[model samples]
Target: MKRKDQMIGSAFLCALLCLLMAVSGCQSMEDQNYTVPAAEKSETVNLKFFGNKNEALNVVAIEEILKAYMEEYPDVNITYESVKGADYFDVLMKRIRSGNGDDIFMINHDTMLELMKTGELADLSGLPTIEDFSPGARSQMTFDGVVPFVPTSISAFGLYCNLGLLAENNLEVPETYAEFLAACEVFSEKDITPIVANNDISLKTLAISRGMFEVYKGGGAEKALEQMNADPSLLAEAMRPGFEMVHLFIDRGYVDAGRTLKTEKTKDDLADFATGSYPFMLTGAWASPRVAALNPGLNYKVYPYPAQEDGSVLVTNVDTRVAVNARSAHVEEAKKFLEYLTQKDVMWEFVDSQSSFSPLEDNRLSSDPAVQPLNAYMTNGRSILGTDSNLKYPIWDLSKESVRGLLKGQSVEEVLGDFEAGLKKSQPGGAQ
Candidate 1:
């Protein structure tokens, strides 16, 4: 009897010991025999991050976010490097080619497709918490269901209507192209330079072209992307109507050709709109807050670019995305880092800090100032479509040259024809 009791006690003690250890292990990821990658197995985790320009993207936010991550995985060492938004592409390319690109990097929506095609980006197939992402948003983050990146948030492109300027002229929101023009005319006549755009040629071109193209094609960014990837031969007449609307704006003498030639920054246009009191500025939602700050209770309401097809067409932009180089020496660590960043807690805090809108679905939509209006756009009566959603790469890229030539002297048809030809040459078995 004594022996049996002792045996039973030993078994109970062992089981209890295991249960206690299991509970402890579950409590802290930090109390481990090894830091992630088991420092015993790997020598070191050298990571670098590249970010775009934004107030919340400043050093303080980056540091705090990374520090939180480090606390969870003590063995990792990360470095933060950034460039001005305008000069970022240049520096990023240089670093990437020199084998020093950050482990995690920011990518443009337009570039994501091209990058994925080249297979230089890591396949984030099983990223943590991706199941929590916004539904359609996944289309932007993936190339054919193969997750290539993790986006922090989504952005939007809309009209930053200067309500005060509109009120001064007794203008209500313009309901049609003609009304839009009339409102501009009033501002122009008053020497307010009705519609101001950033001097950056690309932005001006996209702002003017994106709206018209979407209205013309009757689709969003993804459909247009498919056409671009499919055939360059079919783009001419399809794109003609859109280009015509753009020319119509210039023909009215409302948009200043000379002004665009002299402009290199949106600041020129934004400053003019904010301080110069220009009646309209075609820009992203980010501009909405800045203008509000410039003139408190400015009575401004953000509007989507008026549809040329005379329908509701909203230009949606995806927020910055996190992509790892497939070629990176430390791909495992990099992939783990990307997955960690996508966690609901991590992403929410990042977006909260920036006050930028996020599409993460796990958490409730934000109610804060910066993100509030954007969140409303999702629920409000306004229709939303991805900006480059259906844009054919050729049509999208062609806008640059077409705008330059049309702005200079080329007839709209001639410029569009040239644009089509360029696309044809890029397609296989076409006239390269």
Candidate 2:
């Protein structure tokens, strides 16, 4: 009886040891490759993205991109709404204050700077996509030492060359101010409009080009910015060269200011260009697709506005921003979507479809052969952001009006004087 009892106890001990070893093996496997069971996965997450891309083309392009994202991450539902126009920033701020802001949104320089100071945007420094941005682009998006936004596209201002027109005239694309002037003379003699005089095309582009020449290329960017920050009158000295360039165009009959002052830019300019009546148009890259759509077979290309004789300065700006709301509940998932958008393949397609440049150096958006001249300046660190100089929003308006004033027979000095005065008033800190 005693021997039988000892054997039973030994068998029980053996069973207990086997159970312990089995549990240990399971834990070791878990440590090596842990995954939650299917039942433990989270429910579908919905994210909202609000932006100012309300135009037809913009909406369609963005929707298509989002569709691909949804297909990949079926568990996520995204809603995109556009809130553009004068009250966009006001509406965005109200939503944030109400604790109902979008998971992600678009931001511009002025708005982004204000939101950054208020701590309304998320810090995106840890994102993998941050490593892919061009230094110029990354610096523009960063605020107060924290990156709160990333640009999706670069806004480049250049001349739209009607290659067919240039070829017909036997004029090569202008490489310098002298060449540009000579081209104008040849076009004028042929009774052709050398450049569109519309507000959207001529003035704004020329202003940016001239601004870059004076501020960035001339090495006055730092000093001029400091003076503007100190007092607005200093802008007049910096802007003189650019404003004078516009005056020269008017004086030489290269641009008809009186007609341009009264003309509707979008309608008149598009119709004129579509007829192949003009040889050149000055606009941003945003206008490229529209131009192509209007005249499908027109042979044209965009080149950086010849700011210098050597094509040394290109005027570029951070055109679009993808920012995450600091208070978002779906931060991780929103970040994932942002990451997806910046992937090389997706970025290239987006840039190509939108007719814009990518903001990443690693994935440099190749330019059309006609517009490739601008790329050299961009790659050589000779580009300037529109917002980086004295071209603040208010100053932009003043600059536009200055051109109109010059076209309407106002003297260049008078118009520039008015601009300086208006800029001073716009400064919140009071002119020193």
Candidate 3:
């Protein structure tokens, strides 16, 4: 009996030991090697942005964007330095050449090629957001398969009217060439200059509207633009109507050629328009805020320049572009800012505040009353990008100069001939 009892005790002890061993093994397994993820360390970064929005209102608009960006990225500090007028380009080029370029800067389609020659702008072609850009804007920003900048907003050019003056004059916004002439006559009868522009101005704005109207008259805006690109000289014939339209304005006494030739741009034109000295002015939507800032009580609106056939033609193109410097120490940070700017909410807000349009697949324009008149025109496909045709090439300079010569009393044939000559000279191996 004692032996049996001892044997039972020994069996009980073995079971307890097995249970303890199992528990200890489980504990050891729990304590085995494992890795804990390290927290991401976001380093503080500083970036410098150079832009040409010098007007007070535009400066404020830009500041709003920067403020929002900073809020989202507390560790990133960005400073914007505004460069203004014609001198801005030269100054920026000098800074870039000297290795002192800003981390990010603004560029334009017209100057993109020239700027690229310096080999300073970075290639952003690999960015995923690039696919979101408008076809025309993307083409303009790209060169030889390299994209140097991300277009921020699609810049549009049109006529700005003082609504109060139009109402007082009992004139409806002109839709036809004849209606436009009649309205101008009415304004002239009241002893008001119907149109005013800077000394550097010619019917270039009108020509752009007319040129686009002629090109798009047959329905395929894109196809027609491609043909013009294949052979840029085609623009000479297409753009002739624009010159004639300008001549009509001058001949009808609707505009005083001499005074227009004397008025200074930006300063004089904005002052004239703000003071209600003129009924209409040829300008861009980007300048609308500046006009308002000068005289907040003045009511104004922008519309496409009247076309002979539809009277709803608009000259719309990408204007301000932002790019990063290839040599920037903060390239990744600059790219992050660009990506942040591409967010739909962020992009549309900037476009609306600037009185501009979006270049994204989900395109949108400013909702401001001053810019609403253009909404219908844009939706109806009555607008053309300024980059369409030879305008994207060096031929643009000759085109502007030809318009100036026409304003100076040069014959249409002479001006057109000059353009042809200049176009050939600008081409490789065609110089004479």
Candidate 4:
């Protein structure tokens, strides 16, 4: 009986020891720090970027920037897709509808406004990079006190002069409207085309350059725009001076209306100007490099449009704006990319590649000899924002159509009447 009892006690002791050991193991696990798996801790973030500038050089530059960013941040993977042609906006809209919009995207001023209305663009107001931009540039990108996009470059429209042709005619580059007209007369007498006009944007830019400062500047623009937005007819009255300037150009035979109306912008105009026959081309400064590439020996310079008698005004469009998608899953990562792009060296390289002016406050003056002359106007605050978002009406489209009417041999009054009619049609319950 004693032997059996001792054996039972030994079995009970063994069982108790095993229970204690199991409890000790449980406690050890409970007391220890939990570690996430390596894969879970280092999940990769993927970002997609969309843009419209699909030129070979632009693609290469963008890829280089993305590669450098990825090198600095290993876990981030960015895929860039650039769509060519006017179909880009359509493609972007389709993507957004399908819930596959890019994390970051390029937008123009008008598109930014449209996207902002739909809450598609992230509010980038308090970003550190915002302070880097000049006030004028910031204002252009701002709507209702919210900055929805960052402008990468400023697109300046100017008069591209054939210095060789100007010298041959004993005329210095025109600095005033009067001087420009006089130069045109000289070229007319010599049977040389004074200006290369195109069907697209030449007349619109001309009117903006001539009358933007007078009508839109000096702190009354907001009120004037409000009035015009309320009463569409007031828009024509405000734009009269600019349209009159267009009429004068046609009436003086400075530009052949039929030829100007038929010529496609940046195509035929660029080709004709490259032949060294036209003294001036009314186009954007971005065309300077193309002009050089077309004719390596062409002596040329880009100057502000001779819009004033005392001085010239530079008409600039803030362009190549980038915005973060508000619905992006990787919002922080997308913002980091924008901050990277805003760095001085990176921004400079990108802006220079586009042959555009930087929007940063400390932007360096363009080194291109052709674009250097307009630096003074930029520094002196004589530059006007050509692509304004303050106005409620579609000023740019209206201006283009009005100029088209002018090109079709309509008088200034007739064109203004058409402009008023179109504005009335756009009003609610006015017309179809």
Instruction: Check candidate 2 and list the clashing pairs.
Output: none
lDDT-wise, the better of 2 and 4 is: 4
* Regions of candidate 4 where Cα sits further than 4 Å from its true position: 1-44, 55-57, 83-100, 216-223, 258-264, 421-432
Residue-pair clash count for candidate 4? 0
Best by TM-score: 4
Mark the regions of model 2 whose C-alpha exceeds 4 Å error after superposition: 1-44, 54-61, 82-101, 117-119, 189-191, 218-228, 251-253, 258-268, 309-312, 327-333, 389-398, 404-409, 425-428
Q: Write the per-residue lDDT of candidate 1 for residues 1-432, one digit (tens) a residue.
A: 999999999999999998998887664555546555655575668788887655433356668778988888888988877775557766776777777777888876555655666676888878767777887677666666577777886656666676676777798877556677678777667665666654344333333443345433433545555665686545565566556765666676666767765554435655566674566666656555456556665556666566443633445555677789887888899888877877777777666554456767763554444334445445444444443434435333455566666667678779778877777764546674
Worst 10 residues of 2 by lDDT: 388-397
> What is each predicted model's overall lDDT from 0 to 1?
0.63, 0.74, 0.76, 0.82
What are the per-residue Cα lDDT tens digits for candidate 2 across 94-129?
Answer: 898889999999876667755765688988888897
> RMSD of model 1, in Å?
9.0
Off by over 4 Å in 1: 1-44, 54-60, 201-228, 262-266, 293-297, 309-311, 352-355, 362-397, 425-432
Task: Find the 10 residues in a row with the least total lDDT in model 4.
Answer: 108-117
All candidates: CA RMSD in angstroms? 9.0, 6.6, 8.9, 4.8
